[model samples]
Target chain A: MMLPGFPDAAPLAGLGGGILIGLAAALMLLGAGRIAGVSGIASRALGISDSGMSKSSAWMFIIGLPLGAFIVAVWSGGLDAKFAGTGALIAAGLLVGIGTRLGSGCTSGHGVCGVSRLSQRSVVATVTFMAAGIATVAIMNAMGLEVLQ
Target chain B: MIARYLPPLLSGTLFGGGLALGGMTNPARVRGFLDIFGNWDPTLAFVMGGAVIVMAIAWRIQARLAHPLFAPKFALPTRTDLTPKLIGGSALFGIGWGVAGLCPGPAVAALVIEPASAATFVAAMIAGMGIVRLIEKD
Candidate 1:
Protein backbone atom coordinates (compact mmCIF):
# COMPACT_ATOMS: atom_id res chain seq x y z
CA MET A 1 0.00 0.00 0.00
CA MET A 2 2.45 2.59 1.19
CA LEU A 3 6.00 3.01 -0.04
CA PRO A 4 8.78 3.55 2.48
CA GLY A 5 10.15 7.08 2.73
CA PHE A 6 7.45 8.18 0.28
CA PRO A 7 4.44 8.70 2.47
CA ASP A 8 2.39 10.03 -0.42
CA ALA A 9 2.94 7.03 -2.64
CA ALA A 10 0.14 4.50 -3.16
CA PRO A 11 1.81 1.60 -4.87
CA LEU A 12 -1.03 -0.86 -4.59
CA ALA A 13 -3.62 1.50 -5.95
CA GLY A 14 -1.28 2.46 -8.75
CA LEU A 15 -0.67 -1.15 -9.70
CA GLY A 16 -4.34 -2.04 -9.55
CA GLY A 17 -5.30 0.94 -11.63
CA GLY A 18 -2.56 0.12 -14.09
CA ILE A 19 -3.79 -3.43 -14.55
CA LEU A 20 -7.24 -2.11 -15.32
CA ILE A 21 -5.78 0.25 -17.88
CA GLY A 22 -3.83 -2.59 -19.44
CA LEU A 23 -6.91 -4.75 -19.63
CA ALA A 24 -8.77 -1.89 -21.24
CA ALA A 25 -6.03 -1.48 -23.83
CA ALA A 26 -5.90 -5.23 -24.34
CA LEU A 27 -9.61 -5.28 -25.02
CA MET A 28 -9.19 -2.62 -27.66
CA LEU A 29 -6.32 -4.45 -29.25
CA LEU A 30 -7.85 -7.90 -29.13
CA GLY A 31 -11.48 -7.06 -29.69
CA ALA A 32 -11.32 -4.10 -32.01
CA GLY A 33 -7.85 -4.67 -33.42
CA ARG A 34 -6.82 -1.13 -32.56
CA ILE A 35 -4.00 0.47 -30.67
CA ALA A 36 -6.21 2.62 -28.37
CA GLY A 37 -3.99 5.67 -28.61
CA VAL A 38 -6.11 8.51 -27.22
CA SER A 39 -4.63 11.35 -29.26
CA GLY A 40 -4.99 9.57 -32.58
CA ILE A 41 -8.44 8.36 -31.71
CA ALA A 42 -9.45 11.80 -30.54
CA SER A 43 -8.18 13.31 -33.75
CA ARG A 44 -10.12 10.77 -35.76
CA ALA A 45 -13.25 11.50 -33.77
CA LEU A 46 -12.80 15.24 -34.23
CA GLY A 47 -12.26 14.86 -38.01
CA ILE A 48 -8.74 16.28 -37.71
CA SER A 49 -7.25 13.05 -38.99
CA ASP A 50 -8.57 10.39 -41.33
CA SER A 51 -7.30 7.17 -39.86
CA GLY A 52 -8.64 3.67 -40.48
CA MET A 53 -11.18 3.77 -37.64
CA SER A 54 -14.68 5.07 -38.08
CA LYS A 55 -15.72 8.37 -36.49
CA SER A 56 -18.61 6.79 -34.62
CA SER A 57 -16.34 4.31 -32.89
CA ALA A 58 -13.90 7.06 -32.03
CA TRP A 59 -16.67 9.15 -30.50
CA MET A 60 -17.87 6.21 -28.44
CA PHE A 61 -14.41 5.65 -27.01
CA ILE A 62 -13.99 9.33 -26.25
CA ILE A 63 -17.30 9.45 -24.47
CA GLY A 64 -16.48 6.32 -22.52
CA LEU A 65 -13.36 7.92 -21.05
CA PRO A 66 -15.32 10.41 -18.93
CA LEU A 67 -18.15 8.00 -18.31
CA GLY A 68 -15.80 5.37 -16.85
CA ALA A 69 -14.05 7.90 -14.64
CA PHE A 70 -17.39 9.12 -13.39
CA ILE A 71 -18.41 5.59 -12.42
CA VAL A 72 -15.18 5.07 -10.50
CA ALA A 73 -15.51 8.43 -8.79
CA VAL A 74 -19.03 7.59 -7.68
CA TRP A 75 -18.08 4.15 -6.40
CA SER A 76 -15.00 5.43 -4.53
CA GLY A 77 -16.64 8.44 -2.87
CA GLY A 78 -15.08 11.02 -5.25
CA LEU A 79 -11.95 12.08 -7.07
CA ASP A 80 -9.48 14.84 -6.19
CA ALA A 81 -7.35 16.76 -8.65
CA LYS A 82 -5.24 19.93 -8.91
CA PHE A 83 -4.66 21.84 -12.11
CA ALA A 84 -2.31 24.58 -13.23
CA GLY A 85 -3.43 28.06 -14.18
CA THR A 86 -5.55 28.69 -17.27
CA GLY A 87 -2.56 29.86 -19.25
CA ALA A 88 -0.53 26.83 -18.32
CA LEU A 89 -3.37 24.46 -19.18
CA ILE A 90 -3.82 26.01 -22.58
CA ALA A 91 -0.09 26.04 -23.27
CA ALA A 92 0.33 22.48 -22.16
CA GLY A 93 -2.70 21.33 -24.12
CA LEU A 94 -1.36 22.85 -27.29
CA LEU A 95 2.06 21.34 -26.81
CA VAL A 96 0.58 17.94 -26.05
CA GLY A 97 -1.72 18.10 -29.05
CA ILE A 98 1.03 19.00 -31.47
CA GLY A 99 3.66 16.79 -29.94
CA THR A 100 1.53 13.69 -29.87
CA ARG A 101 0.63 14.20 -33.51
CA LEU A 102 4.28 14.56 -34.48
CA GLY A 103 5.48 11.74 -32.28
CA SER A 104 2.52 9.46 -33.19
CA GLY A 105 1.60 8.59 -29.60
CA CYS A 106 1.53 9.55 -25.91
CA THR A 107 1.96 7.83 -22.53
CA SER A 108 -0.71 5.26 -23.30
CA GLY A 109 0.41 4.53 -26.82
CA HIS A 110 4.15 4.77 -26.38
CA GLY A 111 4.68 4.11 -22.69
CA VAL A 112 2.30 1.21 -22.21
CA CYS A 113 1.23 -0.36 -25.52
CA GLY A 114 4.31 0.32 -27.57
CA VAL A 115 6.81 -0.53 -24.82
CA SER A 116 5.00 -3.76 -24.07
CA ARG A 117 5.41 -4.76 -27.71
CA LEU A 118 9.10 -3.80 -27.55
CA SER A 119 8.89 -1.29 -30.37
CA GLN A 120 12.09 0.72 -30.75
CA ARG A 121 10.29 3.89 -31.75
CA SER A 122 7.98 3.78 -28.77
CA VAL A 123 10.88 3.04 -26.42
CA VAL A 124 12.82 5.99 -27.78
CA ALA A 125 9.84 8.27 -27.58
CA THR A 126 9.04 7.16 -24.04
CA VAL A 127 12.58 7.75 -22.82
CA THR A 128 12.79 11.09 -24.59
CA PHE A 129 9.51 12.37 -23.18
CA MET A 130 10.32 11.07 -19.71
CA ALA A 131 13.67 12.80 -19.75
CA ALA A 132 12.01 15.96 -20.96
CA GLY A 133 9.31 15.68 -18.32
CA ILE A 134 11.84 15.15 -15.52
CA ALA A 135 13.97 18.00 -16.78
CA THR A 136 10.97 20.27 -17.03
CA VAL A 137 9.98 19.50 -13.47
CA ALA A 138 13.49 20.12 -12.25
CA ILE A 139 13.66 23.45 -14.04
CA MET A 140 10.26 24.44 -12.73
CA ASN A 141 11.26 23.54 -9.19
CA ALA A 142 14.44 25.56 -9.50
CA MET A 143 12.43 28.55 -10.71
CA GLY A 144 9.94 28.14 -7.87
CA LEU A 145 7.04 28.03 -10.29
CA GLU A 146 3.98 26.82 -8.40
CA VAL A 147 2.01 25.37 -11.30
CA LEU A 148 0.26 22.77 -9.18
CA GLN A 149 -1.07 23.72 -5.79
CA MET B 1 -22.88 -2.57 -35.08
CA ILE B 2 -22.41 -3.99 -31.64
CA ALA B 3 -19.02 -5.30 -32.57
CA ARG B 4 -17.98 -1.93 -34.00
CA TYR B 5 -19.13 0.24 -31.12
CA LEU B 6 -19.04 -1.84 -27.97
CA PRO B 7 -15.33 -2.58 -27.85
CA PRO B 8 -14.12 1.03 -27.92
CA LEU B 9 -16.79 2.20 -25.55
CA LEU B 10 -15.97 -0.52 -23.08
CA SER B 11 -12.25 -0.07 -23.49
CA GLY B 12 -12.47 3.68 -23.01
CA THR B 13 -14.59 3.30 -19.91
CA LEU B 14 -12.20 0.80 -18.39
CA PHE B 15 -9.28 3.01 -19.32
CA GLY B 16 -10.90 5.97 -17.63
CA GLY B 17 -11.77 4.00 -14.53
CA GLY B 18 -8.25 2.67 -14.33
CA LEU B 19 -6.83 6.18 -14.61
CA ALA B 20 -8.98 7.39 -11.74
CA LEU B 21 -8.18 4.43 -9.50
CA GLY B 22 -4.47 4.58 -10.33
CA GLY B 23 -4.13 8.26 -9.34
CA MET B 24 -3.47 9.27 -12.92
CA THR B 25 -6.45 11.58 -12.67
CA ASN B 26 -4.77 13.50 -9.88
CA PRO B 27 -2.41 16.17 -11.20
CA ALA B 28 -0.67 16.39 -7.86
CA ARG B 29 0.14 12.69 -7.96
CA VAL B 30 1.28 12.88 -11.57
CA ARG B 31 3.45 15.91 -10.91
CA GLY B 32 4.81 14.28 -7.82
CA PHE B 33 5.83 11.27 -9.86
CA LEU B 34 7.45 13.49 -12.43
CA ASP B 35 9.19 15.46 -9.69
CA ILE B 36 11.79 12.80 -9.10
CA PHE B 37 14.37 15.26 -7.83
CA GLY B 38 12.02 17.05 -5.42
CA ASN B 39 9.81 14.88 -3.22
CA TRP B 40 9.35 12.12 -5.74
CA ASP B 41 6.35 9.83 -5.67
CA PRO B 42 6.77 6.34 -7.14
CA THR B 43 3.08 5.58 -7.50
CA LEU B 44 3.15 6.12 -11.28
CA ALA B 45 5.99 3.68 -11.75
CA PHE B 46 3.82 0.95 -10.30
CA VAL B 47 0.97 1.96 -12.57
CA MET B 48 3.22 1.84 -15.63
CA GLY B 49 4.78 -1.39 -14.50
CA GLY B 50 1.46 -3.13 -14.04
CA ALA B 51 0.04 -1.91 -17.31
CA VAL B 52 3.15 -2.86 -19.24
CA ILE B 53 3.23 -6.30 -17.71
CA VAL B 54 -0.35 -7.05 -18.68
CA MET B 55 0.13 -5.62 -22.12
CA ALA B 56 3.25 -7.67 -22.62
CA ILE B 57 1.17 -10.78 -22.11
CA ALA B 58 -1.43 -9.41 -24.50
CA TRP B 59 1.28 -8.89 -27.12
CA ARG B 60 2.30 -12.51 -26.89
CA ILE B 61 -1.29 -13.51 -27.44
CA GLN B 62 -1.45 -11.13 -30.38
CA ALA B 63 1.46 -12.87 -32.07
CA ARG B 64 -0.60 -16.06 -32.24
CA LEU B 65 -3.81 -14.55 -33.53
CA ALA B 66 -4.20 -13.97 -37.23
CA HIS B 67 -6.79 -11.26 -36.69
CA PRO B 68 -8.50 -9.51 -33.84
CA LEU B 69 -11.63 -11.14 -32.50
CA PHE B 70 -14.04 -8.60 -33.97
CA ALA B 71 -11.98 -7.08 -36.70
CA PRO B 72 -10.60 -8.49 -39.90
CA LYS B 73 -7.06 -7.19 -39.39
CA PHE B 74 -4.96 -5.47 -36.77
CA ALA B 75 -4.43 -1.77 -37.41
CA LEU B 76 -1.15 -1.45 -35.57
CA PRO B 77 1.64 0.93 -36.43
CA THR B 78 4.30 -0.55 -38.69
CA ARG B 79 6.88 2.17 -39.08
CA THR B 80 10.06 1.59 -37.14
CA ASP B 81 12.24 4.45 -38.21
CA LEU B 82 13.32 6.95 -35.59
CA THR B 83 12.91 10.48 -36.83
CA PRO B 84 13.53 14.03 -35.70
CA LYS B 85 9.80 14.62 -35.67
CA LEU B 86 9.31 11.85 -33.16
CA ILE B 87 11.99 13.11 -30.79
CA GLY B 88 11.11 16.78 -31.06
CA GLY B 89 7.40 16.19 -30.72
CA SER B 90 7.85 13.90 -27.73
CA ALA B 91 10.12 16.41 -25.99
CA LEU B 92 7.58 19.14 -26.58
CA PHE B 93 4.85 16.85 -25.32
CA GLY B 94 6.93 16.07 -22.23
CA ILE B 95 7.38 19.74 -21.48
CA GLY B 96 3.67 20.26 -21.76
CA TRP B 97 2.94 17.15 -19.69
CA GLY B 98 5.36 18.36 -17.02
CA VAL B 99 3.90 21.85 -17.09
CA ALA B 100 0.33 20.75 -16.51
CA GLY B 101 0.59 17.13 -15.37
CA LEU B 102 -2.16 16.19 -17.82
CA CYS B 103 -2.00 14.12 -21.00
CA PRO B 104 -4.72 13.43 -23.59
CA GLY B 105 -6.29 10.44 -21.82
CA PRO B 106 -6.23 11.81 -18.28
CA ALA B 107 -7.43 15.19 -19.48
CA VAL B 108 -10.49 13.57 -21.05
CA ALA B 109 -11.08 11.28 -18.09
CA ALA B 110 -10.89 14.26 -15.71
CA LEU B 111 -13.68 16.00 -17.61
CA VAL B 112 -16.11 14.64 -15.05
CA ILE B 113 -13.88 15.40 -12.03
CA GLU B 114 -12.95 18.97 -13.02
CA PRO B 115 -15.39 20.00 -15.71
CA ALA B 116 -14.31 23.58 -16.32
CA SER B 117 -10.55 23.00 -16.23
CA ALA B 118 -10.70 19.72 -18.15
CA ALA B 119 -12.94 21.24 -20.79
CA THR B 120 -10.54 24.14 -21.20
CA PHE B 121 -7.57 21.83 -21.65
CA VAL B 122 -9.42 19.57 -24.08
CA ALA B 123 -10.57 22.51 -26.14
CA ALA B 124 -7.05 23.90 -26.29
CA MET B 125 -5.67 20.50 -27.16
CA ILE B 126 -8.12 20.19 -30.04
CA ALA B 127 -7.13 23.61 -31.24
CA GLY B 128 -3.50 22.56 -31.12
CA MET B 129 -4.28 19.47 -33.15
CA GLY B 130 -6.15 21.61 -35.64
CA ILE B 131 -3.13 23.86 -36.03
CA VAL B 132 -0.99 20.87 -36.85
CA ARG B 133 -3.50 19.70 -39.41
CA LEU B 134 -3.40 23.08 -41.07
CA ILE B 135 0.40 23.08 -41.23
CA GLU B 136 0.56 19.54 -42.57
CA LYS B 137 -1.95 20.35 -45.28
CA ASP B 138 0.36 22.94 -46.81
Candidate 2:
Protein backbone atom coordinates (compact mmCIF):
# COMPACT_ATOMS: atom_id res chain seq x y z
CA MET A 1 0.00 0.00 0.00
CA MET A 2 0.97 3.59 -0.53
CA LEU A 3 2.17 5.67 2.38
CA PRO A 4 0.09 8.69 3.50
CA GLY A 5 1.56 11.39 1.28
CA PHE A 6 4.11 9.56 -0.80
CA PRO A 7 2.68 8.65 -4.16
CA ASP A 8 5.89 7.10 -5.49
CA ALA A 9 7.23 5.31 -2.46
CA ALA A 10 7.75 1.53 -2.62
CA PRO A 11 7.60 -0.01 0.84
CA LEU A 12 7.52 -3.61 -0.32
CA ALA A 13 10.52 -3.15 -2.51
CA GLY A 14 12.28 -1.37 0.30
CA LEU A 15 11.65 -4.21 2.76
CA GLY A 16 12.62 -6.90 0.33
CA GLY A 17 15.74 -5.02 -0.58
CA GLY A 18 16.54 -4.47 3.08
CA ILE A 19 16.26 -8.20 3.75
CA LEU A 20 18.79 -8.82 1.03
CA ILE A 21 21.05 -6.23 2.54
CA GLY A 22 20.75 -7.79 5.99
CA LEU A 23 21.46 -11.20 4.59
CA ALA A 24 24.50 -9.87 2.83
CA ALA A 25 25.74 -8.18 5.99
CA ALA A 26 25.08 -11.35 7.98
CA LEU A 27 27.12 -13.33 5.52
CA MET A 28 29.97 -10.89 5.94
CA LEU A 29 29.76 -11.09 9.71
CA LEU A 30 29.34 -14.84 10.05
CA GLY A 31 31.59 -15.79 7.21
CA ALA A 32 34.30 -13.17 7.51
CA GLY A 33 33.78 -11.89 11.03
CA ARG A 34 33.61 -8.31 9.84
CA ILE A 35 31.08 -5.55 9.73
CA ALA A 36 30.25 -4.63 6.15
CA GLY A 37 30.85 -0.92 6.55
CA VAL A 38 31.08 0.33 2.95
CA SER A 39 32.89 3.56 3.64
CA GLY A 40 35.63 1.84 5.59
CA ILE A 41 36.01 -0.81 2.95
CA ALA A 42 35.94 1.61 0.04
CA SER A 43 38.37 3.95 1.70
CA ARG A 44 40.79 1.13 2.35
CA ALA A 45 40.43 -0.16 -1.17
CA LEU A 46 41.22 3.20 -2.67
CA GLY A 47 44.42 3.33 -0.61
CA ILE A 48 43.07 6.51 0.92
CA SER A 49 42.85 5.00 4.38
CA ASP A 50 43.78 1.82 6.18
CA SER A 51 41.36 0.18 8.60
CA GLY A 52 43.34 -3.09 9.02
CA MET A 53 41.66 -5.26 6.36
CA SER A 54 43.88 -6.30 3.49
CA LYS A 55 43.66 -4.14 0.39
CA SER A 56 42.90 -7.23 -1.65
CA SER A 57 39.81 -8.03 0.37
CA ALA A 58 38.73 -4.43 0.28
CA TRP A 59 39.00 -4.28 -3.51
CA MET A 60 37.14 -7.55 -3.83
CA PHE A 61 34.15 -6.19 -1.95
CA ILE A 62 34.32 -2.75 -3.54
CA ILE A 63 34.23 -4.25 -7.04
CA GLY A 64 31.28 -6.39 -6.08
CA LEU A 65 29.20 -3.29 -5.31
CA PRO A 66 28.94 -2.18 -8.92
CA LEU A 67 28.70 -5.72 -10.16
CA GLY A 68 25.63 -6.45 -8.08
CA ALA A 69 24.00 -3.13 -8.87
CA PHE A 70 24.59 -3.69 -12.57
CA ILE A 71 23.01 -7.13 -12.40
CA VAL A 72 19.92 -5.81 -10.66
CA ALA A 73 19.57 -2.85 -12.98
CA VAL A 74 19.75 -5.11 -16.00
CA TRP A 75 17.34 -7.66 -14.54
CA SER A 76 14.80 -5.11 -13.39
CA GLY A 77 14.81 -3.52 -16.86
CA GLY A 78 16.55 -0.39 -15.52
CA LEU A 79 16.19 1.68 -12.39
CA ASP A 80 15.18 5.31 -12.11
CA ALA A 81 17.48 7.78 -10.34
CA LYS A 82 17.59 11.57 -10.13
CA PHE A 83 20.84 13.23 -9.14
CA ALA A 84 21.56 16.77 -8.04
CA GLY A 85 23.50 19.11 -10.27
CA THR A 86 27.25 18.61 -10.74
CA GLY A 87 28.21 21.35 -8.30
CA ALA A 88 25.88 20.08 -5.64
CA LEU A 89 26.96 16.49 -6.22
CA ILE A 90 30.63 17.39 -5.74
CA ALA A 91 29.96 19.42 -2.61
CA ALA A 92 27.76 16.71 -1.14
CA GLY A 93 30.28 14.00 -1.96
CA LEU A 94 33.08 15.89 -0.28
CA LEU A 95 31.01 16.40 2.86
CA VAL A 96 29.92 12.77 2.99
CA GLY A 97 33.45 11.47 2.55
CA ILE A 98 35.02 13.70 5.15
CA GLY A 99 32.18 13.26 7.62
CA THR A 100 32.00 9.48 7.33
CA ARG A 101 35.75 9.16 7.76
CA LEU A 102 35.66 11.31 10.87
CA GLY A 103 32.56 9.55 12.18
CA SER A 104 34.12 6.15 11.32
CA GLY A 105 31.02 4.84 9.53
CA CYS A 106 27.98 5.66 7.41
CA THR A 107 24.42 4.40 6.89
CA SER A 108 25.47 0.83 6.14
CA GLY A 109 27.95 0.49 8.96
CA HIS A 110 26.29 2.62 11.61
CA GLY A 111 22.67 2.73 10.50
CA VAL A 112 22.04 -0.90 9.54
CA CYS A 113 24.87 -3.00 10.93
CA GLY A 114 25.70 -0.89 13.97
CA VAL A 115 22.11 -0.33 15.15
CA SER A 116 21.13 -3.97 14.69
CA ARG A 117 24.09 -5.14 16.75
CA LEU A 118 23.14 -2.62 19.46
CA SER A 119 26.43 -0.77 19.31
CA GLN A 120 25.92 2.32 21.46
CA ARG A 121 28.15 4.45 19.27
CA SER A 122 26.41 3.30 16.09
CA VAL A 123 23.02 3.96 17.60
CA VAL A 124 24.06 7.45 18.61
CA ALA A 125 25.68 8.14 15.27
CA THR A 126 22.64 6.90 13.36
CA VAL A 127 20.27 9.02 15.43
CA THR A 128 22.47 12.06 15.07
CA PHE A 129 22.84 11.69 11.31
CA MET A 130 19.15 11.04 10.76
CA ALA A 131 18.23 14.04 12.86
CA ALA A 132 20.73 16.18 11.01
CA GLY A 133 19.49 14.96 7.67
CA ILE A 134 15.90 15.70 8.62
CA ALA A 135 16.79 19.15 9.87
CA THR A 136 18.86 19.92 6.79
CA VAL A 137 16.03 18.92 4.49
CA ALA A 138 13.50 20.87 6.50
CA ILE A 139 15.67 23.96 6.46
CA MET A 140 16.37 23.64 2.76
CA ASN A 141 12.70 23.28 2.02
CA ALA A 142 11.97 26.38 4.06
CA MET A 143 14.69 28.32 2.26
CA GLY A 144 13.36 27.05 -1.10
CA LEU A 145 16.81 25.71 -1.90
CA GLU A 146 15.90 22.08 -2.48
CA VAL A 147 18.85 20.57 -4.33
CA LEU A 148 17.33 17.42 -5.75
CA GLN A 149 14.71 17.58 -8.45
CA MET B 1 43.58 -16.13 -0.18
CA ILE B 2 40.67 -16.52 -2.56
CA ALA B 3 38.65 -18.06 0.25
CA ARG B 4 39.22 -15.01 2.41
CA TYR B 5 38.07 -12.63 -0.32
CA LEU B 6 35.13 -14.60 -1.71
CA PRO B 7 32.70 -13.97 1.16
CA PRO B 8 33.19 -10.20 1.02
CA LEU B 9 32.77 -10.21 -2.72
CA LEU B 10 29.53 -12.14 -2.49
CA SER B 11 28.29 -9.99 0.36
CA GLY B 12 29.08 -6.81 -1.50
CA THR B 13 27.19 -8.09 -4.52
CA LEU B 14 24.10 -8.78 -2.47
CA PHE B 15 24.42 -5.44 -0.72
CA GLY B 16 24.50 -3.66 -4.05
CA GLY B 17 21.53 -5.58 -5.37
CA GLY B 18 19.55 -4.83 -2.24
CA LEU B 19 20.33 -1.14 -2.49
CA ALA B 20 19.16 -1.11 -6.07
CA LEU B 21 15.96 -3.05 -5.42
CA GLY B 22 15.12 -1.04 -2.33
CA GLY B 23 15.32 2.10 -4.48
CA MET B 24 18.23 3.42 -2.48
CA THR B 25 19.92 4.09 -5.80
CA ASN B 26 17.22 6.63 -6.50
CA PRO B 27 18.11 9.99 -4.99
CA ALA B 28 14.54 11.19 -5.21
CA ARG B 29 13.33 8.24 -3.12
CA VAL B 30 16.04 8.72 -0.51
CA ARG B 31 15.39 12.47 -0.38
CA GLY B 32 11.68 11.78 -0.04
CA PHE B 33 12.37 9.77 3.08
CA LEU B 34 14.64 12.48 4.48
CA ASP B 35 12.04 15.12 3.71
CA ILE B 36 9.95 14.38 6.74
CA PHE B 37 8.72 17.97 6.66
CA GLY B 38 7.92 17.90 3.02
CA ASN B 39 6.07 14.99 1.35
CA TRP B 40 7.55 12.36 3.64
CA ASP B 41 8.13 8.89 2.28
CA PRO B 42 7.87 5.93 4.60
CA THR B 43 9.31 3.42 2.17
CA LEU B 44 12.91 3.87 3.36
CA ALA B 45 11.73 3.15 6.89
CA PHE B 46 10.63 -0.29 5.79
CA VAL B 47 14.00 -0.80 4.21
CA MET B 48 15.84 0.12 7.39
CA GLY B 49 13.44 -1.98 9.51
CA GLY B 50 13.81 -5.06 7.35
CA ALA B 51 17.60 -4.79 7.29
CA VAL B 52 17.87 -4.15 11.03
CA ILE B 53 15.57 -7.05 11.95
CA VAL B 54 17.50 -9.51 9.86
CA MET B 55 20.84 -8.22 11.08
CA ALA B 56 19.59 -8.36 14.67
CA ILE B 57 19.03 -12.07 14.21
CA ALA B 58 22.46 -12.33 12.65
CA TRP B 59 23.98 -10.73 15.71
CA ARG B 60 22.26 -13.34 17.86
CA ILE B 61 23.76 -16.10 15.77
CA GLN B 62 27.12 -14.40 15.94
CA ALA B 63 27.03 -14.45 19.74
CA ARG B 64 26.88 -18.24 19.71
CA LEU B 65 29.73 -18.78 17.30
CA ALA B 66 33.22 -18.84 18.78
CA HIS B 67 34.73 -17.56 15.58
CA PRO B 68 33.71 -16.62 12.09
CA LEU B 69 33.58 -19.21 9.36
CA PHE B 70 36.38 -17.64 7.32
CA ALA B 71 38.24 -15.46 9.77
CA PRO B 72 40.30 -16.25 12.85
CA LYS B 73 38.52 -13.70 15.04
CA PHE B 74 35.53 -11.40 14.89
CA ALA B 75 36.90 -8.07 13.70
CA LEU B 76 34.26 -5.68 14.97
CA PRO B 77 34.39 -2.12 16.22
CA THR B 78 35.02 -1.88 19.96
CA ARG B 79 35.20 1.85 20.42
CA THR B 80 32.62 3.10 22.90
CA ASP B 81 33.71 6.60 23.67
CA LEU B 82 31.53 9.28 22.11
CA THR B 83 33.56 12.26 21.04
CA PRO B 84 32.93 15.60 19.40
CA LYS B 85 34.65 14.29 16.29
CA LEU B 86 32.04 11.56 15.94
CA ILE B 87 29.05 13.81 16.48
CA GLY B 88 30.38 16.62 14.37
CA GLY B 89 31.36 14.34 11.50
CA SER B 90 27.98 12.64 11.54
CA ALA B 91 26.23 16.00 11.44
CA LEU B 92 28.24 16.92 8.38
CA PHE B 93 27.37 13.59 6.80
CA GLY B 94 23.69 14.14 7.51
CA ILE B 95 23.82 17.53 5.87
CA GLY B 96 25.48 16.05 2.80
CA TRP B 97 22.96 13.24 2.65
CA GLY B 98 20.13 15.69 3.02
CA VAL B 99 21.49 17.92 0.30
CA ALA B 100 22.23 15.22 -2.28
CA GLY B 101 20.35 12.14 -1.12
CA LEU B 102 23.54 10.17 -1.77
CA CYS B 103 25.62 8.20 0.71
CA PRO B 104 28.76 6.08 0.30
CA GLY B 105 27.06 2.77 -0.52
CA PRO B 106 24.50 4.15 -2.94
CA ALA B 107 27.05 6.43 -4.53
CA VAL B 108 29.41 3.52 -5.22
CA ALA B 109 26.60 1.24 -6.35
CA ALA B 110 25.39 3.89 -8.74
CA LEU B 111 28.74 3.77 -10.53
CA VAL B 112 27.13 1.36 -12.95
CA ILE B 113 23.68 2.90 -12.93
CA GLU B 114 24.90 6.39 -13.74
CA PRO B 115 28.57 6.32 -14.56
CA ALA B 116 29.24 10.00 -15.18
CA SER B 117 27.40 11.33 -12.18
CA ALA B 118 28.72 8.61 -9.89
CA ALA B 119 32.25 9.10 -11.14
CA THR B 120 32.18 12.80 -10.41
CA PHE B 121 30.85 12.28 -6.91
CA VAL B 122 33.23 9.44 -6.13
CA ALA B 123 36.20 11.47 -7.29
CA ALA B 124 35.26 14.38 -5.10
CA MET B 125 34.57 12.10 -2.17
CA ILE B 126 37.96 10.49 -2.52
CA ALA B 127 39.60 13.89 -2.63
CA GLY B 128 37.69 14.87 0.49
CA MET B 129 38.89 11.79 2.30
CA GLY B 130 42.40 12.46 1.10
CA ILE B 131 42.19 15.93 2.53
CA VAL B 132 41.23 14.45 5.89
CA ARG B 133 44.11 12.03 5.71
CA LEU B 134 46.53 14.84 4.96
CA ILE B 135 45.27 16.96 7.83
CA GLU B 136 45.35 14.03 10.21
CA LYS B 137 48.99 13.40 9.26
CA ASP B 138 49.81 16.46 11.33
Q: Which residue runs of candidate 1 sit more than 4 Å off their true CA positions? A: none
- Tens digit per residue, CA lDDT, model 1, B1-138: 787788999999999999999989888899899999999999999999999999999999999999999989999999999999999999999999999999999999999999988888889999988998999999
- Model 1's chain A TM-score stands at 0.97
Model 1 agreement with the true structure over A55-123: per-residue lDDT tens digits = 998999999999999999999999889988899899999999999998888999999999999999999
Worst 10 residues of 1 chain A by lDDT: A1-10
Docking class of 2: high
CAPRI verdict on model 1?
A: high
Chain B TM-score, one value per candidate, order as shown: 0.98, 0.96
What DockQ values do the models have? 0.89, 0.85
The best candidate in terms of lDDT: 1
lDDT of 2 by residue, A1-149 (tens): 66665678898999999998999999989998988899889889988886657899888888988888999999999999998889989999999999999998899999999999889899999999999999988898899995764
RMSD of 1: 0.8
For candidate 2, the TM-score is 0.97
Task: Please list the residue runs of candidate 2 whose C-alpha ends up more than 4 Å from where it truly belongs after superposition.
Answer: none
